[model samples]
Target chain A: MHELSIAKNIIEIVKESVEEKDLSEVDKVVLKIGDLSGVVPASLLFSLEAITNNTELENAGYEVINVPFIVKCNTCGKESNNEAGIVRCTLCGSNDTGIISGNELLVSEIILKN
Target chain B: MSVITVERKILAKNDEIAEQNRELLKQNDVFTINLVSSPGSGKTSLLEKTISLIGSKVNISVIEGDVQTSLDAERVANYNVPVVSIVTNGACHLEAKLVQDAINNLDLAKTELLFIENVGNLVCPAGFDLGEEMKIVVVSTTEGDDKPLKYPKMFRNSDVMIINKIDLIPYVNCDISKLKDNALLINPGLKIFEVSCTSGEGIKEWCNWLIENVKGKYIHQTQLVY
Candidate 1:
């Protein structure tokens, strides 16, 4: 699945940050994925587990936090949730809206050993 | 155990390189488009038709992305235009770093229009930005009308959604109006085009929109791009 590639990229990102911080090993990583991000969390974790095994970061655990999609109507300037894949305005019933959040794919934290 | 807040986007590295690509294309005055779609959505066919219709008037080049095979590149090459192929091996989507590498292999500066045909998958391609002026997602009538609600992220991120294979509409059990309404419900401002690559029904308007968005020719039109 495509989640494996994303998991690999996460490893790369962690590697870069770990190297930059001069950390010897990683213990845990925190990821915040938005509802509209198009990522399947279970599949991503499955790939992460398979990847971290038998490696220097073998003991590393991952935590994924799901985020909700929110949008603001461009016409009425009203903010609302868009998790169900509907991009309409909550107040004026206008479909003209811009998504303000919920497409996140961030690596927010890295638990490391001294 | 110590927790350090990295607060970094997992695809930040991709976005970082994408910025560099935008700068490179901006310097060249090239109008770049990242064309994305599900497999067998006629993305290649649309490009071939587009090139055939207006390739002579404009210096258009394409970077074709497929999991395996250079066949798509060969198809575009039949039009006597510059085309490069990026074989992703088994990856489902194309990344910006790969596109940056591909651009290095092409002469984008002299080209007026550059189309990056992304790997044929709707889900993964929406997440990666490849330094393009805009992203265009092509869906076929056979894919059904509920795709907008099914694959919301792709439609949400795309500036234009080209519903291809309209000629097959009569043969398929699909509602074209439902597709349009559903797409707009997901992205109200999504410029949509119903085109038949087989009969070349709506190629002119699409080409006109591309021409208008061309470098130094962009005069932001309030109306949708046909």
Candidate 2:
């Protein structure tokens, strides 16, 4: 899966942070992934586990926070759920809706040993 | 032990490199388009047809990304254009680092238009930016009309969508309007084009749109430089 590359990215980010802190041990990493980010959380976790082998992240546990897809209607200013793959506003029946969230993929936190 | 809330996007490194690529292309007055699609969606055919029609008129170069083959690069090189193939081995998308490396081998000073054919993937490619002026998604008539709904990330991120292989529409159980409607539902402002590289129908209009967008602002910017 392409999640390996994303896993690599996550490792790189965590490595950089760990290096900055001069800590050889990292405990945990928290990532926030939006439902609409196109990354399957399970696939990413599997990829992350594989690539983290024997690295600074190998012993580190990770968690992914799923963010809900939210979109605002352009015509009626109503927000609605966009997780269904169809992005029409629920209240307005208008297709002109802009997604404000649910595409996020970020490393939110890293826990390290003191 | 302590928790450091970093709140950093994992793909930030890719984005930074993409911005650099974008600026470098802009400085060279080159317009770049990242063409993304699924396997067998006819991205190569679209490029070949475009090159055949306007290869003489414009100085174009291509950066081809594939998982394991340079065959696409070989096909594109036949047009006598500067083409570079990036074999990602097993990667599903083209990252900014790969594009940066690809551009190093291209003669950008003489190139007016650049096309980076992203690895044939609709899902992963949508999340990576290679610093293109626009991201175009090409889907064939054979792939069903609901592809946009299935691969919403690609459709939502793309600026334009090309419905290819229109010549096969009569034989397949696909509706051209259904594809457009689905895409519009995901991205209301997405510019859509329909064409058949084999039959050459609608190819002219599609190429014309590319030429206009690439040249219109290019002329103005170059004149300013002069």
Candidate 3:
């Protein structure tokens, strides 16, 4: 799955960061995956485990924080979470809007031990 | 003896590579299209039809991304055009780094149009940018009309939506209007085309639009030199 490739990238990023900081082991990897990012946290973790085997992050635990999609309605000036993928304003029901957040796939923090 | 908090995005490296790929394509005056769809959505067939219609006039090359077999690359090879297949080895999508490598392996000097056919998947590919000029999403009528609503991100990211297998509409119950409506709802400026690759219906218009867009951009760039 694509998760494997994503996981591979995660490993590389973590490896580089750990090496740069001269850390010997990775304790945990915390990720923030947005609802609209189209990534499944469980699948990503599974792939991470398989790929990180025998690596410095082999014992590293994964923590996934789900980020809900939020949008701002331009016409109604309403801010709300857009779980349904609808762009309409909740108050005025106008289709005009702008995405405030979500669609993010990022490594929020990495814990490394000396 | 201390714990360091490293706050960084895992995809930062991949995104950096993708931006480099974008710059390379832009500098080469080449138009690249990353075509994404579900398996059996007539992606290769559409490419076949497209080559048959416009290959002689335009310089086209293809990079076929698949999880395993080279079957799709083999199909494009018959056209006598340059094609490179990158087997993902069970990966569901193509990343920017892979595309960058594929481009380096090919001859970009003679290529005007480069097509990267991504591994057939609706979700993951939407998140990764391959540094293409545009993203074309293919959804056949047989796959149903609710795809836009179900997979809104893919539809929203795509610049064009190709509704394939229109010939099968008679045998299957699919609402073309609903598909267009839903896609338009996601992206108001999305250009859509309904075609049947097997029957050669509407293929001409599709190819013509592609050529015109590319050539138009080329001409516009050339005019700026003076």
Candidate 4:
């Protein structure tokens, strides 16, 4: 899927962050993936593993933090987690709601072996 | 062990290029749209219909993205508008960088409205921004009404939803009203249009909307320039 592309982007980001450092020193890459980010964590991890093989980052693992889809009601100001992925207010039943979170695809942190 | 705080978007590079594209298109005053849909959702047919209806009124250009062939580009080229095709080889989606490269070969100066037809996919395209003013998602009646629920990200990210192949509504199980309801549940602000690209139904309304949008943005920009 597109996870390969995403994996490549992650690798690029990690490499950029590492700069002149050895990639072998990196322990794990922490990622914050949203429910609605159009990414499958397992697929992305597999892709990362497949592409990083024989490279310095082969031993590095990935930690994914799944973010829930949350929307804020424009009418009643109610913030609710949408497990079903509907963009409606949970309290007021209004359609005028805005997404507050759950679309994130971020590389939040990187850990190194001491 | 040491932990470094990155706190950066994974697609930050792509987003940066997309922003550059947005600025470039904005400076050229080209109103562009990123059209997305599932495979065989009649994206090309809708494009053909839209182009036929509004090609003379507006200077149109197209960027077609496919995994293999330039078939869609060839079809669009028949309209005599500037069209370019990006074959991703095996990639499922089109990124902003690909679009940035594709635009380089086009005549942006003569283009008023540009359409970037993303690879026939609902999942991957939702996450990638291709520097379009709006994203239009097409779903045909044969695809069923629950497409919005199944692909909420695509529906949520899109500004407009075009329900194509309405001519097959009688034979298909899709409930148009339910489709709209399902899509609206995910995106309240989505402007919807029902059309049968085959029978020429609702094409005029969609073209009119496109023309008005092109005029609206250009007028606002020209006023600022003057």
Best by TM-score: 4
**Could you tell me how far off, in angstroms, the CA of residue B42 lies in candidate 1 after the best superposition?**
0.5
Off by over 4 Å in 4: B218-226
Best by lDDT: 4
lDDT tens digits, residues B55-106, model 3?
8878899999999999999999899889999999987889898999999988
Candidate 2 off by > 4 Å: A19-25, B218-226
| Model 2: per-residue Cα lDDT over B81-168, one tens digit each | 9999999998888999999999999999999999999999889999998999999999999999999999998998899999999999
Model 4 C-alpha lDDT per residue in residues A1-114, reported as the tens digit of each score: 999989999999999998556689999999999999989999999999999999999999999999999999889988999854698887889988888889899999999997
If ranked by lDDT, best first, what sequence of candidates would result?
Answer: 4, 2, 1, 3
Q: Model 3 compared with the native: what TM-score? A: 0.90
For all the predictions, what are the DockQ values? 0.72, 0.73, 0.55, 0.83
Every model's TM-score = 0.92, 0.94, 0.90, 0.96
lDDT of 4 by residue, B1-226 (tens): 9898999999999999999999999989899999999999999999999888778878999999999999999999999999989999999999999999999989999999999999999999989999999899999999999999999999988999999999999999989999999999998889999999999998888887778889885454222110
Better of 1 and 2 by DockQ: 2
Task: Name the candidate, 1 or 3, with the larger DockQ value.
Answer: 1
**Residue A28 local lDDT, model 1:** 82
Model 1: lDDT of residue B163: 93
DockQ of 2: 0.73
Question: Per-residue CA lDDT of candidate 1, range A1-114, in tens?
Answer: 778978988999888778754434687899999998899999999999898788777678889998888888888988998656688887899876777888899999998876
Q: lDDT tens digits, residues A12-103, model 2?
A: 88877777444457888899998788889899999988987875467788888989989988999988876645688878789877788888
Compared with the true structure, the alpha-carbon lDDT of candidate 4 equals: 0.91
Which consecutive 10 residues in model 2 chain B have the weakest lDDT in total?
Answer: B217-226
Which regions of candidate 3 are displaced past 4 Å? A19-25, A88-93, A112-114, B1-5, B220-226
Fraction of native contacts, model 3: 0.60
